[model samples]
Target: MSRWLPWAVGLVAAVLALGPALGPGYVLRYDMVFVPDLSLPTVLRGADGFPRAIPSDAVVAALSWVLPGDAVQSAALAAVFVVGAAGAARLMPSPAAAVVAGAAYVWNPFVAERLLLGQWAMLLGYAGLPWVVGAARGPLAGVVRSLIPAAVGGFSSVVLTALTAGPVALWGRGGLRRGGLLAGALVVVSLPWLVPALTAGAAGATTDPAGVEAFAPRADTPLGTAGSLFLLGGVWNAHAVPAGYGDPVAVALRLALCLAAVAGWAWWLYRDRPGFGPGLTAAAVLGFGVALLGATEPGRGVLAWLIGLWPGFGPLRDGQLYVAPLALVQALGLGAAALWLSRPAGGTADGPGDGGAGAAGRGAGEPGSSAEPGPAGPGGRRAHGVGRIAGVAAAAGLAVLPVVALPGLLWGAQGALAPAEYPRDWLAAQAAVAADDRPGAVLVLPWSAYRGIDWSGGPAVVLDPATRLFDRRTVWNDDLVVGTPDGGTVVVRGEDGLAREAAAVLGPDPRTGLPESLDAAGLAALGVRYVAVSAPVDNRFWSDVDGFSVVVEGPEMTLLEVLAGPINTEEADISGLEVTCGLVTVGAIIWSVARSGSSLGFQRTGVERRPGARKEIP
Candidate 1:
């Protein structure tokens, strides 16, 4: 069971990593997508528009687009697992000790979260940095290959912002000068996009306040401020993302496992070479950071100082990303501790050169110490020490107990998957819209209904009644943009004249209703011809409208031909509303999902409830 345990955990982990791409969460946004480039519909759909930040999941998306999700996630995960194991083995002081470290990491919740929740940026950083660290201390050939890591770190920066830059800049034992020079070069190169982004940012485009945004939040409040830092330190059981995100059970278990790992790591370091000093220094600094950040003024003084000093950190608002390095360091330390703990307490019974035993206790001063430093590198006849059993047990505890709590996770994933409880409506209304997208027609379909228009090159705007009238804020933008007035063939949807009413709010068509024919109007100028409405009555927005033409009717959705009136200033205003909505809706979904949930599981659970409702409500 112990031997198979690692493989079993790995297989399940791989599957969980594959879940996002294989399931509805990824595909659901295929329609209202935002790409990194401002040019809409040019490439992939993203939560943010044309931003340098790429979703870390894009790696998985690219892979899933080609092969199956399982293979892609597994391969990526395998690389992390293997590299992590190798690193531990090299440092564990013994081969068996290294094995124990491997078991601990593979089964840890930190690794589990990264794999399962699409934390590709962190994973990528882990993959690249270790290689860079090895290269920094290894041969010239390794340094030359370090370019691979440097380059990957550049892309990962786009995912996690400037956070990934830390490992690349400082992973090696090289002096600060060398690290500074390398980091400076990377920063200079990264500036093209960063510059434009800052320039764009300077324009002060307001970030769409989606979810429970604590905009202009009170950094002065002691309790809230303390809560933020507590959350950041991973000291008080931090959730994964957004606000209060993370499994409570996983949170508790994660904390316990993390503690175990850190303790074991300390033991390993001490066993390999006794030194309470460095570990004590690290603890002091961390505790200080926690204290300073938790003070009444979170944005000033020591909290600010910590952020500035936290190497490679850039301007970031959220405190969650700050905790990553500490987590990894703790894990590595734990692995080392496990190595030490695994060795026989009596002494180097294995032999003087044995690493496992060397790691377990300071023992008789071996040549590897300052006295010997061993026979140079891995080629040295170092003793292979026994692995730590407690570390293994702790890791095992995490993997198994989670299984015990699987029932809770089911509710979590299922709830997240079921956010919006809308009745299923398939292609019923889609049939009426032209199958092939025609270039010249000013086509208009009901909001959220894209039957025929080729979204391949253009974008879809929802012309729903609820959207046009009530509050006018959309996930896209807080306000709408009105369009130029030109009489276009109006295609009204459904039996209700509400589409007409929604149409009338803009201009000439407000009371008169959509005209019967439109020919001379330019596609963009005339707005949309043939509106589609779903409701049959003169609903809230449509009660004042004249009539509508139903092209198709079905049990599920209805399609109608709506003749919209001449484009006027009123229409232009509405178009701005679209832009506003697109800004809020398209740009902020990821921010919302990652940051807004009451609990970490809620992010996933809330997603299933009704994605639209979540945005709409707040």
Candidate 2:
């Protein structure tokens, strides 16, 4: 019952939070875009810049072969909540505390904002954090097994795992060796994207420093940037915040909850001295400090300098991502609070004793070895009257507090995440392109990366689905345009050299993203065989074009085929290096799993307990 309770809690939370989003079709928003029959070859071929979608999209495409794309998306989204809740819950010492921790872990502002932003891949890694923390002290195989979700999430997830759990591995026994093993595991899992990124030459290795200001953490609450960050809600994009989430009442309540959770964590650290506590505390502090770096002028300057020095520092631009470790800390702290609240007055719970050596020896989530709830003490003496009832009620109230404080996340983020089906024209356009054995790339017009589609009933801004709709490569604009709070705009330069070359030849309008006239000779020279207008256009520019034939034309999409010309018919295929690295990563993971002989879902019993072990409080 205890083992299943966390899963049940996670499912309920997922249903309540996702609501209509859990139905059919794709929930397209921001970076989240899913198409029917996503082409694995196209995903592997990737774009000119960083292979951000590499293994994530590759995995999705592989799964789409077995399941409908929509079902795959639904399962992926649901897994975020389910896996996250279960992992966080299992970290707690007591079952009741586990429930509180699990709920708090998935129901926070960080999860809400990231989900709204449609970064499901990043969320998947976030879900696996607790498991990584728990496995940090164990064998290398255990750590590799725990990293499966992060492996699927790609680069950002791997970095997050390193930030959150790396310290824990270092702080454990045989610190250096364990830390090296963890580092090796990360490198092995990161090969799919890492190999491409390293070999991408100067163009792919450098990023615009403008992203430092554009993507820095911003205040989303009346409590200001620091306070909002403390509450785990300082995402950069304003549109990503849940509806009515900034209400003053909600802000106050959330702040109070954060303070209580922090205090509870302090108490737990002092009392139980959990093995992962010191390292987790260090991670939380370091992560929070890193987040703060982007919140100030000097810090932003430093970040920009770092990015200028090397593009590898690009991830630091989005400092809000680092707050994820703090979110985990607060979640576990809330669970510790529940443990304290539910325990009988002047008596500890069933598992460990206060400041006892036995408490420090046990690993996280070692069932029956940590704490458990009851009115009785170690001596089997039960509490009577109001004391037990009060304790139970208080613990229960703490469990419900996270939901009450962040009401905006309920019911599919106030219906902002409702699913919408693709129009027939869009599907037809995709099929038309897929059926053709095209040797050249598809050029996505409007010459932009993102689109505000009306198919979702309301205009939902998402990365153009047409970019990945075809069975082959599609070249589109990759530059990012960010709107500032002061009504100004920042255009961050793109990394795709090929896209830049195409842009120079096509010369798209800055305002409309559409070309003034068709340059058929120029496009054919660039190896563009087909042009897809993914958005509704007021003017049909391709109608009178000389060197093109219309393939599919509708209100929503227009596909054009270039007429006979000297087309650069270079075939795009996955590089041998990328294939080799992917194969190696897969093999490593399989070997690690085989060596471990136990799945990540099950716990290893009879762990050797080291007595008199003490961890420093950060």
Candidate 3:
């Protein structure tokens, strides 16, 4: 209970501090466009409902049953920060060190940019890193423990965790066997998303190599990319940078802090301590290397080769995403730095209750009765001098904390800003969509999937709310859009033809009527029955639209009923595969739980004897 007190307090405090930004309204930024639609079966299935490969969608869908969809999304965001902090603490030597590292991890420029860009899906992977680290270090460590976060966060965390497990197994006794078990566990958990992702190409959801490189970290060379990796500043969207980010002073300050943090952590790593293991250092370097691969031509070639081998490997398109593991590394480094700053005049940080080697051993949960002994006394003057330099650098890092955290970062987490409230017109439009008794799809005009909805109070590109707003089946564009409202027409960055068709259907001349250019028969073939037009976009094309009548016209939306023909195409058949994967995951989980002396049906507990220990109740 005492072990949990710090975490509970920190989580509650974080929620209160962040509530204003994340409470009530729906954030309309980037992929947050889809969060509100978490309850929709079609969205959970993803992209024309052919692929149930989106693990985040599955989590949202499951939670939506118990909580409001928006609340679930909000809670999930808070959980990422909270869990990430907990994980940082779990991997650190003392509570204070953990708090510093947790703060660094959750409240950094990288986290801010991702949250602002609405990369909550990827953030889940980031949040799960600490858990992966913790599980790897525990006495009962196994493949299942190492890969459980993968079940929650998908392949991103799986790759990162696997990297961490590599050094863990390789650098320790029985390493190979343990590593193999971890790999097998990863495969089992991955079947949920991996099986569907492998088959997604057949469902027209393939990501071309060009698309894969679209969000590649932009750097002059692999070395430059590696440099940026440690700094935590390689977002694909330049606009995603924090306010005043490029200022010379800000850059220099951030760079200095980054170096200090890394140096401090490096110092701690060399110590024969029980803090974060060698695996984290190895994982950080590997993650940085992978992130750099996208920026260099040779690296891109390697990436191309990998993509060629695995079709489901498309999500790694955002090369910057690989920087996730590094963020944790930086946090750890900063935590180690903080410990150095708190050290007394002595070079050795073995003071009573100081959380140096002793705290490290306890935190690591190593099979030891007490902290390892330190040198009998302070060694020399040169040692103290070197310690002082490291302490000063750590202090500098502490200074830069606010600059990287605060609301100055691209308007401080766009998704966390006051939520966009559902307008009355949106409610009416949703009701209208719900009234359609026939099986049909609702298409929102100005057909691009990403739009700069003015209500969210920022220029961040967000997914069209219509996808979630309409309770009926939705026929919308499928592409990763990155742009601003003032930037004019939103650009379709992905190579999906359906997205291009959506742009073409909207036509070059938006002032002209939509039906004038659209073939009603063609649309009928796709099962589109109604079109909802939101404000600020030209709807003159609808004035001359034939065979359709305005069903509901509100301040925010104009719904038009399609009168032409019945849609002919068969609904996609994905239920069988979705069900199969769900059943397999559930079965595995149930079996694992049962083997652990637990039951989902009722409260049942059992304990067995361990070697050199007495038998427990069963």
The C-alpha RMSD in Å for every predicted model, in order, reads 15.8, 3.8, 7.3
Q: TM per model?
A: 0.49, 0.93, 0.79
Query: Which residue runs does candidate 1 get wrong by more than 4 Å?
Result: 1-12, 16-41, 44-52, 55-174, 180-256, 270-315, 348-475, 478-618
Tens-digit lDDT string for candidate 2 (1-618): 666778888898999899888898888999988889999887877767888778789889999999999899988998999999988887776667888998999999999999988999999999999988888788888888889889999989999999999998898578798789889999999998888777753345468999999998999999889888999999999999987678998888898889989999998777666777888899999999999999999999999999999888999999999999999999989988887777655445424422122344453235434433334555444453355567768877887888899888898888888888888888998898878885888999888887788886456789888888899878899999999889998888988887898999989998889988889988998888999998777545877679999888788998889884878866656679989999999988888788888776664211123345343221
* Sequence-dependent TM-score of model 3: 0.79
The positional error of residue 602 in candidate 1, measured at the CA in angstroms, is: 37
Candidate 3, residue 487: Cα displacement in angstroms equals 11
Model 3, residue 34: distance off in Å is 5.2
Badly placed stretches (over 4 Å) of model 3 are 5-19, 34-37, 48-53, 137-149, 164-171, 199-204, 219-226, 273-276, 301-316, 343-347, 350-416, 481-516, 536-540, 587-618
Stretches > 4 Å off in candidate 2 = 200-203, 352-390, 604-618
lDDT, each prediction? 0.34, 0.83, 0.59
Ten-residue region with minimum lDDT total, candidate 1: 601-610
lDDT of 1 by residue, 398-477 (tens): 43543343322222232321111111222333333434242212233233332212222222122232111111111111
How many clashes in each candidate?
100, 0, 6
Return the lDDT, model 2, position 525: 88
